[model samples]
Structures are given as structure tokens and as C-alpha cells.
Target: MFVSQPQYEFPFPPDLEQPGSQHWRMVELTLHAPWFLLTVEIFDAEMLDCSMSRTICIAWDYDLAEVLRGLDPETVLGIVCMMPAWASPNGQWSSKEVREVWMCSSPAGQSVLLVDPAGEEFDCGLVPEHVEPLKKDLVLRVAPAKPRRRPHSRRKTPPTGNRRSRRASARKSEA
Candidate 1:
């Protein structure tokens, strides 16, 4: 038997320039095994332009606060990912590689800063026009705890009245 997974919809911020033009919005965030993926959907008016995905290794166990910390004005943001060692003519060499990923920044307000492996900044044109909504969506995914609810019982309550009296009444009614 096959089972379907639940699909969750998150609230997205309004479009950047009115409603009937081009804009970018974050559509989904999902964990695919060892990688955590953030997907951005681009829209040209009502039509979908394309989708872009950015991923980070799940081993890092990054949380919302840790992600937002990269935006701190006083701190220099640098995220490095370690790679497997390779064999060379001389000997084995371990490589410390940095992949292109999204980094947060707060120059005016929260925004995404895209940096290449060479430490150069470039615009992917996929970053949402506004980022606060994206941040809120990330927080919801990281800590999606809902208020606890009491479990309901399926068994019906016992008939109200003395057991003997109820039996006697039932007998009389049958007669």
C-alpha cells in the first residue's frame, strides 16, 4: 500500500510591485535527507517564471536564530562546508569547500545576500522583493509547535440511570 505525505501551505508576504507584475516569492522549504532546501518561485504577472532552490547540509543543524545571526551588522558572516578528502600524487588531501548559498543581511532590514564560492556577491534575481515574510516562514518551519488539544473519547457514556431500573424499564417496554 502507498501512503501520501501531508502538504503544508505557509503564508507569504505580498508581492513587491502591486499585484500584476513580475515578482519573486518563497513557496516551500523542505528537508530532503541530508540537505535542507529552500525553494523560491518566480512569477511574471500570473504566470510562473521559474523556481530556484538553495540547499545547505543538514549536519549543521542550523536554526532560525543562527541563520538570522548572519545578518548582524557587527558580525562578519561566513559559512563553510567541509568536503571529503581526495587522493593526490603526493598524498591524501582534505578539502574545505564553500558552496554558493544564501546568507542573511540586515543593511536596512532583513534581506538575502547571495555569495559565490569566490566570496563575490551577485544577484540571482530570485530573492524575494521583501524578505521579512520569508524570515517569518522560516521561523514557523523551524519551530512549528501548535497549542495542545485534549484527545476526545470515541466510547459513548453509560446510560443515565440505575442499571437494574434501566433493565426493568426495558423489559416492560418489550412486553
Candidate 2:
């Protein structure tokens, strides 16, 4: 059956550098504390002339602290996907867009929620072996907790016992 696809617009309008010569290309997807920060590198391509072209690379870092608050870190996985989209020549939309896919995995990393480029959610039949490695590869940058200083002891040993012990030793030495 032949079916037409529905169009989807990006949440934000693409930045227009020139009047009608702006297009963005997805260069890289970086997950910094995937659970907290998601960064995507995009290159803006603009035609300078008939034979020359210029591209400016920019990094868009999204802070998910507010969005991902209270989520369990161990089971949460941030999937960054580059989606192909139709963009206008005026740079109102980029050719490619980066979207963050939030998913949960089982303790054994067997269960996973997968979201495709079309925003369709589905279950991946089996967990990829690399999922564990990918999770391990994540470098978490967090400040170490400050060491707690213990309070000083207030009880003091009685001097009378020490004096008696010293006297007994001296008497034994004299004898």
C-alpha cells in the first residue's frame, strides 16, 4: 500500500545567516553525561559563489538537568539520533536535525525502548552486546564529595591511675 508520510517541523526555527543561502548538516553527536547534557555539532553551509562554498561548524549543547531530574542513572540511556528533514533554502529549517531519545534498559541491558527517526517508538527485539560497552564508555564528570572532619574527643584519661601505676613501678624498681 502506498501511503504518504506526515511532515514534521523542528521545535526551533533554523538560524538564517544570509537571505536564502543557509543549510545545516549534522556533523557529530556527542553525549556529555548523556543523562544530563546532550551536544550536537552542526555545520552551516552557505554558498559564497558558483564555485565556492563556506561552512561554519557550531556546537549545540542541551542541558537536560531540568528535563531529566529524578531519573535513575543506571537504567536511563540518552540516544541522540540524527534525523533527515526537508529544509527551506532560506535556512528556516536544517537539512538534518538532532533529537534526544530517552530510553530505559533492564538490569541485564536486555530490554530497551527504541525511537526511530520518524518519532515512532518501538522495542528492539534483542539488546545489542555493545550496549553495555557503550554505557561503560560514558565518562561521568562529577565533583568528589568533601571529606568530613570528625569532632575532637572531649574525654580525658584520669591522671590518678597513671600516678599509681608509676609509683608501683618505682617501688618495684627500689625493691
Give the candidate number with the greatest TM-score.
Answer: 1
Model 1: per-residue Cα lDDT over 90-167, one tens digit each: 443332222233444433344334333466553323344554434321211111112322235353554468532100
Q: Quote model 1's TM-score.
A: 0.19
> Per-residue alpha-carbon lDDT of model 2 for 102-131, expressed as tens digits?
334334553334333465553323344434
Off by over 4 Å in 2: 1-80, 83-100, 110-119, 122-175
Candidate 1: C-alpha lDDT: 0.30
Can you give the lDDT of residue 89 in candidate 2?
40
